[model samples]
Target: MTAEFAVALPSVILLLALLLAGSAAGVTQLRVEEAARGGARALARGAAVGEVGDIVRRLAGETARSEVALDGEWGRVTVTGRVPGAVGTLVPWVLSATAWARPEAPGAAIQPAVDGTSREARLGT
Candidate 1:
């Protein structure tokens, strides 16, 4: 019984370490994705490029980086960051996410729906 217990202990510890590493990687990826989305939203709202980058870094981490690309009326943001943990040390896991949004024209008014319903009508006001 002692021999079997000793043999299983290392395996359990290793498995727990792997699980913790995987959880960390997943959380990091989620942070990267949220950062990309926030950056994209800021860009679409006509924020400056520097502001967008700051938003991304704040949402993700100081080590995270962002890229912005604009084509016509659309804006795109990509956020990348290193996964933090044993997994990253062993495998160099780099997680990234991209988000796209259409920039609203400066001072553009909100257009009514295609059906021509006004806000007051929809709200029963």
Candidate 2:
């Protein structure tokens, strides 16, 4: 029994550590995604390009690096970010999200048509 426990302990510890790291990665990914959604919403409302970039940068912070791109005419926004792992790996994982919204059309103008002849005359003739 003692030999069996000793053999399994290292593997168990490694498994738990990996699980914890994976959970941390998942949380970081969720944060990055939320930041992207916020950036897109701001940009869709006709916010300035610089303002949108600043918003994303502030949201991402040191944990994740982020970039925002906007298509003003189409009202489309794309955000990309990289979330670093807890492990000291040099290559950070990348994630991206995009959103778009179209501006509502203005109400149409109502105009009345005119005729050269008087209204009663035109109606009768």
Candidate 3:
């Protein structure tokens, strides 16, 4: 019984570790996705380019990277980052999330910037 237990213990431990890593990766991906969507919405509402990056970083994490650009009237935002692992050396992988949004009408309210400026002042609100 002892011999069998010893052999199976290692496999169980490894499986748990893999599960943990996968869970972390999934949560990180969700955060990145949320950040990207927020950034895209801000951009579409005519928020300043300078502020979009700040908003994404805050919503995601400081380690997250964001790219926002406008194509014609469409805006796209992409966020990429990696989740840290148990021993501090294993990065599961670099994950990316993206979102797209379209410009609103001039009479629409704008989104507030990271700096506390009202959407109305920014002219989207």
By lDDT, the better pick of 1 and 3 is 1
**What would the per-residue lDDT of candidate 2 be over residues 6-122, giving only the tens digit for each residue?**
999999998987787677667766666676666556655655545555676666554444443323344444555555555525445666665554433343211111332221111
* lDDT per residue (tens digit) for residues 45-98 in model 3: 778756788788888888888765555456677888788688224654888888
TM-score of each: 0.81, 0.62, 0.77
17: Cα error in model 1, Å: 1.2
For model 1, how does the per-residue alpha-carbon lDDT over 26-95 read when each residue is reduced to its tens digit? Answer: 9999999999999888877777676787898889998887877665566678888888876678888889
Clashes in each model (backbone N, CA, C under 3 Å)? 0, 0, 4
lDDT of prediction 2: 0.52
Compute the lDDT for candidate 3: 0.73
lDDT of 3 at 74: 64
By descending lDDT, how would the candidates be arranged?
1, 3, 2
Give the lowest summed-lDDT range of ten residues in model 3.
116-125
The candidate with the higher TM-score, 1 or 2, is 1
lDDT of each: 0.76, 0.52, 0.73
**RMSD per prediction, one decimal?**
12.4, 17.9, 7.0
Question: Alpha-carbon error at 102 in model 3, in Å?
Answer: 1.6
Error of 3 at 115 (Å): 19
